[model samples]
Target: MDISKYNFYVGTSRGTLLFNSDKPNNIQSAKSEEISEVTSLNFGRNENELLIGYDNGCVNIFDIIERKYIKTPELQGEGRVVGIGYVNKSIVIGKHDGIINVWNGKRNNYFDTHLDEKGTLDTLVCNENRHGVIGTGGEFNDLKLWDIETQQCIFKAKSLGHDMLNLPIPTSVRGITFFPEDNYLSVCATKEGHVLLYDDRAQRRPVVKFLEKKASYTTIACAYRERQCLAGTTRGYMQVMDMKAGKCLRTFTNFTGSITSIVCDPLEPYVITTCLDRHLRIHNLETKELLHKVYMKQNLTKVLVKSIVKDEPVEDTSEKEKVDEEYEEIFENMETVVSSKKLKKQKRHDEDVTDKPRRKKKKKLKQAEG
Candidate 1:
């Protein structure tokens, strides 16, 4: 597969850019003075329009075919626009003040609000079936699902708790994703350092929880097409988990700083992670191999890969490739074994401490001896 044809849209702290992922590394200036800091981005279904949400309460629409900035009346909000997603012809923008605004291309009065609280919109996800789900961070640590057609919140799940006196508000729910080919939802955040899978059709609590070291999870991506999920941790590690078994299958540790964004190639099923260390890495999920690495000058906040062709041929593997696959599988399984052992040891230590009897010194025994 020609990797160069894949175009990447990167949302940075300074602004956003379109870069050619192929050999020459061509960077195109997509947005100019329109945005000061890009907080989120979404590409239209047609791939012609690029929507960028800024930290200064502004969203810009760029025409990719025309190669010019298309003017949409600026979205007005009280806080920074943190998340953006596109479904059909409508644009969903989530703000830091816990407000979701749906903008249709036709009218100026086309704005529908879904959330009204004090929280940062961390991620906006549109499922393969075009279902809209929004994950909130900071003050409100919960995930809320919305029905786009009716513009109503259908379900809300609270996953994290906080102390009202010291911390006051809930910690951030950094990432949320829908499982592949199922109604399961995966949520990850800081403080607890665990990935939670919740069955939307059943109970309120999580169905399974996969714990990690004390690293804040910044981003997560579900390979709904590939039946796997990838999580990017604050400690610069990428954990690939099996969605069905709720297990951490592999860990990639090439990054030096916190991982800010993670995504899967829609067509290739390869994982791409961007980190504050200024490196973007492409990993093959099946073999756990690092395919490509690109070094950037700036701290990459978000990295998204756009598959040019919808119907690409799958690569056929030979006997030699199968041998390599076996080796990769062993490496991945070994990591899981080590992690499980560590968790077991930690649990045993906790049990030992809790089971220890308190020491009591009796004054009556001393008096009798005297």
Candidate 2:
């Protein structure tokens, strides 16, 4: 809530967890009683208020300062909510059914729009340079731009023409972000592990593409540098690249699974990432060094970090060392735990195969031949 302090909120399977960001690494977590997982998280028009979307089709607003939920607004449709963004005092809900609901307030004032009807919505971004302009991307669909006030689709990217060797380009978008300096310029990550920059005003095709064989980017952050940005990939790595030069500057990896979401601390040179390995990591953007890491009980999907460097150091060094030792044990078990999850999934698949009926063999004909 307080922008001056170092803090953050993490969205997980059970609910949201608030990290105190203290030197000793204290955590305060809140679980939703009726929800199985938190689908989306956004800061409202007021920075102190947080809007949370649940898998059970409920939207709740919370005050970050008081660490308390304010209200639960009624939603029109019920489905798995994927992405949420706050713009112009309204909350935009991106659902798994491809429905984008724009709710103004708690009085049931909302409007609906469709994204990718066949697939789940993957990312939603509000333009910092352009008012009323928003972007949405899905699993198999291309990126789309819309004006929420007018409730109309303004732009849709076309599949790129050809590759260097005359091969067709892939258009499935994985993550998207608008350039803060220019409203017409936007960047997106494709399923092919490529980062493409699109100029909405100039042409439908991308202006530049980078990281052809690096990693499958799942999420991106835009505030790390002036002409460069950071992107989190499906292979549990993060890369910083120069958009104009189409070059990768650095890469960071601290998790064993996919990086789901990333946020850059505006006040410090830090980047926070949430991963499917049930870890939240803080790293230096320039040095690519791990500053601090926390292993939550649930897999974190999204993270909102405020600050990384505290103004004053804690007096007790033993307390900090004790917490770090505990986290080290937790971090050491992350890989084993994640592997167990994969084993469980494989076991379920094996059970499904064993559930099928097998054909019986004939006996009399074989005996006569013998």
Candidate 3:
């Protein structure tokens, strides 16, 4: 598999690290852009400009190509910025303490609001094609969709009802992401090891919910397919799920620590992941194979795949040639191999004929005596 086509950003404990997938020693000595730890990441309309949310609840606009700061909008807060995204010309930021801030560049103004004033949000995602809509959820809050323009809730998800024993199951949302192909569809992963799919047009409750045993999902990402989502657990169990069927389609293993973040390539069959084990990895979603792994030196939080300016396909034919060479090695002495097999058959025929002749001679001697 050729990974040289992708360029992505990984958020770490120190800062955000940039890497190209083609490198042999990616992120080996790559310096981070910011000093503060990155808590969230998003791309602007240009795709070249990146929006970085810091643990300090501040958002910075950075040009990934130029490797420079584009803008640092003035804001003061003391919470982790859990989400950052764009709507037309405005920047919307969601903090852990349920505070949501939106900044409009046209008016050079901003507004701030809270999600009911009390609970913390673990996941906040802006709908890409939904025209200024966003979704936010957490351990204490139910999954909700909001219209950023009016600051009103468009839909609110109801928590799971009582169990078979009549005991209410708690809601703990760990990750949330909008399906790229559908504006009304969104998926969420919870600490309770459940993945829920919601369509705001259908109902406030999830249309489908699937449970992955022994998996407390830490991160979730929507695959390029229509109704597929990839989920990663704290125990490093990763699997692709068919959200419509509510079943696991395939699983990718061999991870050592918690799966902190996941990102699927928009135009490729690759899934990029960052883990607490300090390794950035790319896996082939089609073959369930680990294509590349790079060690970053610190725990990674989030990763974003940048848009490709130009894509040049790279194929390594050396492996294919090596396999052909191995096949040739098996019968290097082709004539001798054939002769040896033939020689074994000849020996067996000689033994069979010699015994029969001996029996005939003995019978002829007995007949002459009679």
Candidate 4:
């Protein structure tokens, strides 16, 4: 599936603009000014409207077919809007002040609000089944799953305490995504470079955690029909993880800067990632090969690859083979008895030599006595 037909809307500190990816990397300037540093963006499910959430607490909707900005009267607001998602005909805007505003597409009215007055909204996501989940990236550091219709928090996963490991301190949950068919939630952070898998039906602790030391995970997407998850890190690395086994399946390190966003091709398992290196890259899931790369003048913070094909698989390696290779590496790194015994013997030898009497000490003591 080719993404050449798709146009890109990028939000920057200066303003927001539309760029045709098929063009010569030149942005078609939109009329909006000072777009509040777009922190998150989402297109409507039917591709009718494009939603842009900004740092200055404004959510703007644009008409894609008509190529005009829809002047939604009630949708205008002033808060640090951090995340945006579309569910059915509803547009969800998550703000830095911890309020989730739901907007109706037909009427263009503010329908509901899910407010957590204590925390900040870090990420907002909606699955194929229309289940909406919000990750709060503040001192609370928890994931809240809500019923969009009722605006009630159905489930909550609190953050694990600090001092738990030698890993970096977690800033806030940068992103959260649910498995396509399962009850699993993939949680990523801005500080700790790890993807945590938590089962909603189970207790609070994560069932599996995939930790990497390179950089923080800024965004993640699940494969089209598999249990694998694709993640983008701040260091410009893209990795696929099998949530079932809690291991990284494949890794691609081609981007020159931090990866800000990632999304799976709607039709296939191919993954698309945007980086601060000012490039958009498409990778085939099966082969872990980069299919396309488009350089841009703007540092892309988010990317979405809307697919026209429905149910085709991208060519890549098998999941089982990848898992086995990861397992082999884990076993190879296991400490051996011989190494443990040698370390103990060395410690004992150093203690014995230190405990022996020193002629210099005796001479100093005699001098003091005299």
lDDT (0 to 1) per candidate: 0.68, 0.75, 0.80, 0.66
| Model 1 residue 336 lDDT score | 42
Candidate 4 per-residue C-alpha lDDT over 15-89 given as tens digits, one digit per residue, 9 for 90 to 100: 465456345355465656544566777877567667776666766776766766654444443467767777656
Regions of model 3 farther than 4 Å from truth: 21-24, 28-34, 106-118, 311-370
In order of lDDT, best first, we have 3, 2, 1, 4
> Cα deviation of 119 in candidate 3 (Å)?
2.0
Candidate 1 per-residue lDDT, tens place, 327-348, comes to: 9998988844458889899999
Residue 228 Cα positional deviation in candidate 1, in Å, after optimal superposition: 2.2
Q: Give candidate 1's error at residue 144 in angstroms.
A: 1.2
User: Which pairs clash in model 4?
Assistant: 57-79, 286-315, 286-316, 286-317, 287-316
Against the hidden reference, what TM-scores do the models get?
A: 0.73, 0.75, 0.77, 0.71
lDDT of 2 by residue, 166-205 (tens): 9866666777887777788889987778788889888887
RMSD of each: 27.6, 30.0, 13.8, 26.4
The candidate with the higher lDDT, 2 or 4, is 2
User: Which candidate, 1 or 3, has the higher lDDT?
Assistant: 3
TM-score, cand. 4 vs. native: 0.71
Number of the predicted model whose TM-score against the real structure is largest: 3
Overall local distance difference test of candidate 4: 0.66
| Runs off by more than 4 Å, candidate 4 | 1-13, 21-31, 74-78, 105-118, 130-139, 162-171, 183-186, 309-370
* Better candidate by TM-score, 1 or 4: 1
